[model samples]
Target chain A: MMDYKYIEQLLERYWQCETTLEEEQILRSFFHQGDVPEHLRQYNDIFNYESEAKSEHLSEDFKQKMIDLVEEDTAVEAKTITLSQRFAPLMKAAAIVAMALTIGNVAERAMRENSASEVAGAPVIADTYTRTEDVKATIKVIDQNQSAIMAKADSVKTMDLIDEQPEIIE
Target chain B: MKEISFKNDILPLGDLLFRLALRIVGGNRPEAEDIVQDTLIRLWENKEQLADINNIQSYAMTICRNLALDHKEKFENQNISLCETDHDRADDHDSPDKALIKKQQYETAEQIINQLPEKQRTLVQLRDIEGKNYQEMADITGLTLADVKVTLFRARQTLKEKLSRLAQ
Candidate 1:
């Protein structure tokens, strides 16, 4: 008692392109059995054709050939990649060198400016907090200058006085 | 959408792709072979984006289909014979009577299918033969869901009517 009615309905659904993949596969499996009922025999070829077609494939060597071909492309691409790789290290070194030189020059200029300022402002920096010996040396130099000027004034005053006394005697 | 490596995942699809190319270009195995190889190479070229695709099988199938049709168009433009049915290839393993019947069926099925426009022909091959679902069909053929159904329905109807006519 084969289920002819179910097969018929499935066939109808199949022709309408409405069958699920499992249902369709079932149809194929059913047709694959050697003794498809008379009405289904004609449809057997159609279902079997799909399986036969699926078995068709390219040659075994094709994969290797394709790999070779794709690798050839990769070789060309790798060449360009290597070219970029080669320049990368050089560019990096140049950038590092430039950075080092800039930092070194800036540091040297700062050091030079500090030394120059130390030389230029050495007296001012010392005088702001002069030691007692430094003050005594400055006071001594000032007293010497004052004494010389006083001595010259005394000589001039004496000359004037002598002239006045002579007039009185006359 | 699992991870798809080009060598691990995509390169193995060559045979599947070859079948699709053979179907689209009407059984020119050599051209289909070249097209399949070219499609694989193209996949390799675009391997960077292979993982981004939701389905690598359908993606490769689609590329194989387009390249096959492109080659078919160029083949047609050259005014060469586009019909190259390889029925003899099926004869090697079948029993004599069975092989005869298969060859006849194959030739008839091919004749009926080749009469169709490329889309419907490919739709039939993808659906009935490949057993691909509607969405995969849509993805491979670049057709909308409704259009895939309509086209596949039409192809099925045409096959039914034609096969029945041959029976009668």
Candidate 2:
């Protein structure tokens, strides 16, 4: 016959909240051993129920389901970028380069036309001014020649009149 | 701080949390399962702060307890009594009458426990069923150590008195 006096004392302490966890565990072990006095049998159900309830567990299916749910959550949180999205910065750079080239071509053409018009009109204005100056110089030279000829002709007529007036005076 | 894997560290706590939830929700298994799922997901969502906690199991228990209580409040009227389906296992050595008597004793003890108030019931579950010390119980329950002892004493006394009556 085994002694249960210690178990009884432990049970008394257990109800008073004075038993250590180990001591309570000892009581549990004792009650689960299947041979108890008639007086101690009433307490068997409590310990047995406690021990059996620990067997109440969530199934493996529950575990796998939870893992799937969590993994799905992680998948949703981290979305994968497509190839196009990955090259978005490069695409933006290419578009900007294309736009800049188009603008440069248009601006260069506008500048070329402006300079070409200036070059085409510049010589015409210079030639017109040069021709006006030439005409003025030609007119001045003709005026000087006509004045010298008139002076010379007047001198010769005075000489002829001197010679005829001498003969009339005799 | 050690790195905590959700698979290794947190997932394994599902059974413990489920048991606690089952007790808090008054043996509503489906609701208990839901509460545990919510608790685990919540813990995983807050995994960043888990490394800072001293005891992750106690922290998880606290979260499970709070969520179970919230669920219990929402569906208070629909709670099934505890141990309603807890039939005793048959022993080959025992006679049929002995097995029936054992079953009745279990059912009676369960009914007596179920009649306890929610706080006392939870204390009993945490201490006797879970084998948590007073400090762990205090931590899980957010009660002071003295308060835990007092509450557990009252709960154990109630169980003892009711169990003695059943013996009579």
lDDT of 1 by residue, B41-145 (tens): 888778778878878889989988999888888886653445564667778977999889878876666667767778988988887778889989998888999
As a TM-score, model 1 comes out at 0.68
State, as a TM-score between 0 and 1, how close model 2 is to the true structure.
Answer: 0.71
Instruction: State the displacement of the C-alpha of residue B125, model 1, in Å, after optimal TM-score superposition.
Output: 1.8
lDDT of 2 by residue, A3-121 (tens): 87888898999999999888888888888888889999888888877766676788799999999999889888866899999999999999999999999999999998898688867
Model 1, A1-170: lDDT tens digits are 67689889999999887899989988888886667887677676677777577777777788777777767776777443677788999999999999999999999999889986977578766776678676787777667655655675577765554333222121
Candidate topping TM-score: 2
Give me the candidate number with maximum DockQ.
2
The CA lDDT of each predicted structure is 0.79, 0.83
Residue pairs clashing in model 2 are none
For every candidate, the chain B TM-score is: 0.85, 0.87
Candidate 2, backbone clash total: 0
The i-RMS of every model, in angstroms, reads: 1.7, 1.4
